[model samples]
Target: MVLSYMEGFLLGLGAAVPLGPINILIMNESVKRYKNGVIIGLGAMSSDITYLFLIMFGLMIYVNQPEILNGLSLFGGVFLIYLAYTIYKNRDTKIDIPIQQVAKKSSMKLYLKGYILTSVNPYTVGFWFSVSGYIAGKELNPFITLFGMLSAILLWITLMPYLVHRSRHKISQRVSHWISLVSSIILFGFGIMMFINLFYN
Candidate 1:
């Protein structure tokens, strides 16, 4: 059980540390306000917890269906495209509008953005399905694995925002602009790729 937990921790880090929509949002928001990023991560984490519960109840098989995955990809792709457009459109906006106050007011919106983004992402769903299937196939302890995964993910959520928040003072206007622009392009590219994959694969 201990060994399984250790392995699960490593797996969790592997899964969460990779470049993904949630990570991008966390990093981008952290540069402006620590709480924004932390809330986003918490929201994303909530969706993951939901899937973990489904897996625990042996309902992940439904999520593995091709049609369901494809449907998620479709929605995710469209939503991502819209977000890209929104970010690019507001590229000229300044961050000096008192982020703490704005964050308090827009807390729900930001949380929903993170939760919706993760929930619609086919990759996120597929990955969880795959991981759960692997554990079941191996006859491993699901509770131990899930506990480790939760711990590692929580660690990431805490540390990542703190680090970015600390360095936010050094980031300049031009750098921030480029970050937004590049993020917009990358998100657009991801959306296009998701669409292309649906037809090709």
Candidate 2:
């Protein structure tokens, strides 16, 4: 059991460290408003927990169906495209607004954006399904495994924003603009790739 818990923790940490749309968005937000980035992480973590529950309870059998998975992928692709467009549109907007006011006004929006962005990806569901299967095969306690994973995810989200916030002074406006542009391009590419995969595979 102890070994299993440790494995779960390592697996969770590895999974959460990947470069994805959510991570990019969190980093971008953190460079501006640290609190908003943390909120976004919370939202993403919530979605991860939901996927964990679904996989543990064997609901992933339904989620793995090709038709349902394809539909989800389609939605995710479209949403990513929309997000890329939004980011590009706002790329030039100065982040001169007061942090307090921005947080108060956009907290829910940021949270929802994170949740929706993470949840819509069929790949996320598939990854959790595989991870859950591995845990089951190892005879690990589901609760322990989930707890370990959640802890890793929470730690990552919290630490990432804190680090970015601390380094905000070092990041120049031109650098920030480049980051936003690069992030938008990456998201758009991912969205296009999803569509291509859907059609070809």
Q: How far out, in Å, is residue 127 in model 1?
A: 1.2
For candidate 2, the per-residue lDDT at 31 reads 77
lDDT of 1 by residue, 93-143 (tens): 566556645444288887887888888888888789788878888787888
**Structural RMSD, model 2:** 1.8
Tell me the tens digit of each residue's lDDT in model 2 across 91-195.
765555556655343788889888988888877887887887788798888788777888888999999999998887777767777878998999998888889
Candidate achieving the largest lDDT:
2
For model 2, the run of ten residues with the poorest summed lDDT: 96-105
After superposition on all CA atoms, what RMSD does each candidate show versus the true structure?
1.9, 1.8
Candidate lDDT values, in order: 0.82, 0.83
- lDDT of candidate 2? 0.83
Candidate 1 to native Cα RMSD, angstroms: 1.9
Clashing pairs in 2: none
Enumerate clash totals for all models, in the order shown.
Answer: 0, 0
